[model samples]
Target: MNRLTVRAAIHVAAIFAIYLSVAMLIPAAVDLFYDNDDWQAFAFSAVLMGGLALAVALATQGRPPPVSTRFGFLLVNMLWMTLAVAGAVPFMISSLDLSLTDAVFESVSGITTTGSTVISGLDQAPPGILMWRSLLSFMGGLGVIALGLFLLPFLNIGGVSYFKIESSDIEDRPFERFQIFTLSLIGIYSTLVFTCALCYAMAGMNGFDAVNHAMSTVATGGFSTHDSSFGYYADNMAILWTGIVFMLIGGLPFSIMILFVLRGHVDALRDPQIRVYGGYCLVFSLVIAIYLTVANGTPFLQAVTHSAFNLISIITTSGFASDDYSLWGPFAVVCFFVATFLGGCSGSTTGGIKAYRFLILFELLANGLRRLIYPNTVTPVRYGDRTIGDDMQRAVILFIAAFLVLWAITAMLLGATGLDFITALSGALTSLTNVGPGLGPIIGPAGNFSSLPNAAKWICTAAMLLGRLEILAVLVIFTPAFWVR
Candidate 1:
């Protein structure tokens, strides 16, 4: 195999290793300060991950695989599975008594930033375990970001091509160029995390919980310190908005962010994706809040708090909840469900079909009608003035179709596991979309997944991986031709 080919798995493995190494140290410090026995869990988990990482690194030393389309898909799937496995080690080793399946499910949930926990007594859980959960979520947030920067652009999902911006995330780019961009992106990512941590601490949480939730929150990951989630602070209103701002940043394009940061080009904030993404948030959130307050008899303050937080959460694909949305009535449930598919911008940590695709689709629809209304009218459907091509349009349609089909199939398969109708349906959709929370009382924004059966656990595990790698990337690997070589 060529060096790049040899190193392909390690490339992902190395990232896993590095993240694990850094993460292992976190609980050590926590243990030292808190005098919690959870230090042993962190130590064992770190040693295991570090050793595993070393083996892969040495075995593939100086050899990197040239990732092709098929291999890219394979790598995406394998990478998530590997991390899910590795991530589960800490949770399993902890005294929480999580079964292997539950541990892996929780780990998969964390790294995928899905936030569906199997542990119920979170309030009584060890600090180290909680931090690791958030850390896994934080790392998972970066995983998707890095993948977008490097992998999805290659797949041409939605229209990420607009961001021809370069960095280490793209494989075809030169090393120095890639390093420069990756480092800058990481810097920006870290800054957002730190700023949120500070702000959240000021908002109300203890310093440690603030830092933990802040990392997860900024990633739109929604791993909270308490079981009540954001509802634990229904008394605090500004904190809800504080989460909204970070959630938006977490869903923004980092490249434009870097430009604005470097040159103070204030217009960079006006990037088309940013505009549409934020506009979606503002419009729909208001609609929901109005409905809740006027139509549903919800108190105004409570309406706004839950509406804004959950809007930001679902639109950004973050899973936080200020109140049990299950009780909000059918319109609210469906509203949140629709929000999952309309995830944040392309270059964001949030997952789902994304907003730009819908924007372009709507533009195309308008253009078609105009052409019919006036045959001589030369109206070009554009996304920010760039004409939409037939190929891009077809790709968008095919993407939406494939995503729905996959979701349906996944849901049916989960149903076979004996879960009830709503749990299976919403669970499958939530997993396929990589959105953390689902509908219904059991797995809703206010609930956990610990009550699921073992078979159900595996089904969700697969669904989470599918969501992260995306349908096409991993599905292509199953074709007869993909394994012919």
Candidate 2:
């Protein structure tokens, strides 16, 4: 990337930092309304972060610089890290008195929509911190939708180029320009959050909890207001059903949602990835529900409800838990662990090896087996109506391989910090997948990450960033070729 592009990316990040600082005031006001002194922490953070961000933005001000594909990766990494630091400031100075490591861990988790937290006593925590967490998730979710739709396809990260072609080929595109499309995206996103919030309120959550959960649910973020998460409302079938519906929506492709909502393109909902994602959710939910009914002897309807909620939460990487599936025997534990890696649709907020990649991988495997049988078989791998390209196949295979390698490496690092096997393994998987709650006792559904060593927290934080960026985007920057002119 050119010097001009670097400056432009920094400028954009600075402006984002300013917006983040302003957002902090919402929580600050909440704290003030609740008569909590944490408002002071937010005030100090907003002023400090906003002032520095303003200076940087002013220094880099100029005509819009040309954006290169290389610069897209840079801008994304820079923006996320900058906003995470900006988000951490309040936590550092808040009444909770978190260490810098803990604050950054919470902040990174929120911005990545990872939802892994270090703080405990969330049921009675200050409103400011809680609001800040949800806001970060909300913003992070929006930012990632834009990233997946606009940047990843153009950058051709992990076979996402297929989406760019499909989107561009549409004769009646939703919006003619990027700015207009962004506005539509935001409008649709805000509408979803609003609807979810209203449903939560009608289901008996107070306004604050409803709004916070609405943000988290729509983001597929899973940052609950209470330590028990959805368990706090376990008996509230209304709320649980509401969450199930919205979380399913959160897991589907936002592009399809936009087209269906804005352009009345109902056929867009039939996209192959959508069908496959739905199928995965259905199959996993049913399997778990059956286990709950037969083995655990839970009531059939109750088992289905809890199983659907928790399984969809895991597959979507939403991480909300109504019951601890970890205690549901070895089979259930294995199922949940596998579901952690089955993230939702590619253009959505959820993370992990996305449903589309799995689709691609399966096609590749079948094609390979066919070639072995027929020797010169002429079968072209197909996804929906389109034939899969060799480039996309290679990208998908490499991405999955890299993901597993990184997960193993991260687990090793965590184990080195004295964590047990389950904690280290699931911690690595959860962080890389941006799925909150590991499988073990410490960081499981019932526990937070407060007890993890500082080094382990940092490792998880780095893994969260890597996972959020889809691994390759950040890893590519480390290559010698990336820096060459």
Tens-place lDDT digits, model 2, residues 1-485:
57887898899999999999999999999999999999999999999999999999999988776767778888888899999989999998999999999999999999998899999999999999999999999999998788788787777677456575444323456577878777888999999999999999999999999999999999988899999999999999899999999999998878778878878887787788888889989998889889889998989888889999999999888889998889988998999999999999978999989888988888888988988999987998888777878777778887888999999999999999999999999999999999899988899999999999999999999999999988888898888887676
lDDT against the true structure, per candidate, is 0.78, 0.90
The runs of at least 3 residues in candidate 2 whose Cα sits more than 4 Å from the true structure, single-residue gaps closed, are 165-174
Clashes within 3 Å, all models in order: 12, 0
Span of 10 residues, lowest total lDDT, candidate 1 = 165-174
Off by over 4 Å in 1: 1-7, 11-15, 65-67, 158-162, 165-176, 367-381, 389-391
Looking at candidate 1, what is the lDDT of residue 347? 71
Tell me the RMSD of model 2 versus the true structure.
Answer: 1.3
